[model samples]
Target: MPTPPRVLTIAGSDSGGGAGIQADLKTMLALGVHGMSVIAAVTAQNSLGVQGYWELPPVAVRAQLDSVLSDIGTQAVKTGMLASTVLVETVAEVLADVTVPIIVDPVGVSKHGDSLLAPDALDAVRSVLLPLATVVTPNLWEVEQLTGIKVDEENRLRDAAEAVRALGPEWVLIKGGHLPGEPVDLLFDGTSEYRFAAARHDNRHTHGTGCTLASAIASHLALGSDVVEAVGRAKEYVTGAIEHGFPLGEGIGPVDHAWLQRR
Candidate 1:
């Protein structure tokens, strides 16, 4: 049998199993890729919120990356929730030499409005990390966090994408789920632009949407899709997952990564 395409996720462990490393790996599996992880932090999280988180030492984080890249190499990588400057820099340094697709989620806050990325690490993300990304996926909130540009309406998405693109990523995907009306995401790479729209799923169980989308993109890239094709495919997968999102604990639940199999 042919070996499956390998994809690596460098992120935090979401104890809730909804977002972060858990979500990324689940999405990878659902998309038919071999998933690997380098846990940069551990979160005491649940559906309710992230109570607290602790970053792994930089040395340990580097060790995990080296172990994965040196032997069982990956075709693509996705990053989220580094939580500190050192962690971000450490990941960026190692990933700089990797000649594969890199998807950066730029996870700044949890679904419950809990802060995940530290205030100080924002600079490192802009300077060191994003430059090496094949695609940088940032929600409106994160756009403002990184570029001080607020995107309130659909027309402003291009502006947000441009601002983020200036920071160095080859492509920028601005997630507009937070806006009113049907969900629309703008994908821009300096000149070209593509818009993906999905029916607004009124499900409140949309916890892992960001992590899931980024991981799905990485999976498709590993499967040999270009940036545009990868993002398009990822959007479709995430839309189905969102439509099938099911309630779990007391608060918001997770998107069903197995929605395809279950259907």
Candidate 2:
């Protein structure tokens, strides 16, 4: 039997199956990778908005990570929605021994504008989690949340990328979807920089975009693609997902994770 490309997601759980761990696992499966998850938080949410959330105890989170990494092994690891400082530190400690590529999705807020990260956890994420990242993916809001740099236009993206690169990641992918006009992302890898631009989709069902993009990048990385190549394919995948996003509950819906499979 062929060895399957394995990717792990350390993130919150979305009972609605739109974003968080649900979206990450869906993206991995759609991209032909075996997906594993160590949920950090459990959220009571749907399209309308987040109703409640509970952070998993650090011990439980560590146990799950230990079980997965010690047995199945991960080719790549992607993280999202660590609710508290303790959770962030716990994940950082658990991943210290894993040698594979790590993709950090500095998830700060939900698609519905609900705050996900605790104000106290910013320091832990910046100091501990970011250094272990092979690629740190931060959207516009998250960049400002983490670095205090405002990204108003294309030019400021470089400034923001630079601020995040200073934190210690090998690469930084600053998503510009929240900006106007064409959607573009800036990637900086210390010595070099690359910009990826895509046509903006007019769809409103763009939930789970951040999680899906990060997971897709991890999937490509597990498949042996380089940073640039993995990011390029991930952008293409997310664009398609956004264009075909699905309308679910009463509010913003989820991106169409199965769209690629049916094509």
Candidate 3:
């Protein structure tokens, strides 16, 4: 049998199994990739919110990256929450030499509005990490945080994507999930553009949507999809996951990573 496409996720661990590393790995598996991980931080998180987090030492982060890339190489990589400036730099340095397509979810906050990326790390992400990304996925909130470009309204969303694109990633996807009306996510490479619109499910349980979307994109790229095709397919998969999203704990629940099989 042919070996499964291998994918790597370098992100924080979400104890709730809703986002971060858990979500990324689950999305990879659901999309038919062999998921590998490098835990950059561990969070005390649940349906409610992020209570606290502790970043792994830079040395440990590097070690894990080396361990994965040295032997079980990945065809694609997805990065979620690297919680600190040091962690961001560490990940950026390691990923710089990797030739695989990288999908970076510039995770800035949790579903409950808790900050995940360190303020000090924003510059590192802009300078070091974004350059190494094949694509950077940032929600409206993150778009403002990273680029000082406010996506306060729909009209300015494209301006925000261009600002993020200016930071160096070959592609930028500014998710407009927080905006009113139907959810519209815009994906732009320097030249062309693609807009993905989905009927906004009224459900409030979309805790892992960001992580899942980025990993799904990485998985599609690993499967040989072009940038536009990968983003299109990832949007479809995430929409299905959101549609099947079942409520979990007292607060927000997770997107159903296994929604495909369950159907």
- Top lDDT hit: 1
TM-score of each: 0.99, 0.99, 0.98
Across 1-263, the per-residue lDDT of candidate 3 in tens digits comes to 99999999999999999899999999988999999999999999999999999999999999999999999899999999998899999999889899999999998899899988889999999999999899999998899898788887778878988899999999999899899889999998887878999988878889899999999999999999999999999999999999888788899999999999998
lDDT of 2 by residue, 1-263 (tens): 89789999999999999999999999999999999999999999999999989999999999999899989999999999999999999999888888999999999989888889899999999999999999999998899998999889888999999999999999999999888889999999987999999999888999899999999999999999999999999999999999999889789999999998878
Best by TM-score: 1
> How far does residue 210 in candidate 3 sit from its true spot (Å)?
0.3
- Whole-model lDDT, model 1: 0.97
In model 2, the number of clashes is 0
- Residue 214, candidate 3: alpha-carbon lDDT: 97
What is the C-alpha lDDT profile of model 1 across 171-225, one tens digit per residue? 9999999999999999999999999999998799999999999999999999999
Lowest-scoring 10 consecutive residues by lDDT in candidate 3?
Answer: 148-157
Backbone clash count for every predicted candidate, in the order shown: 0, 0, 0
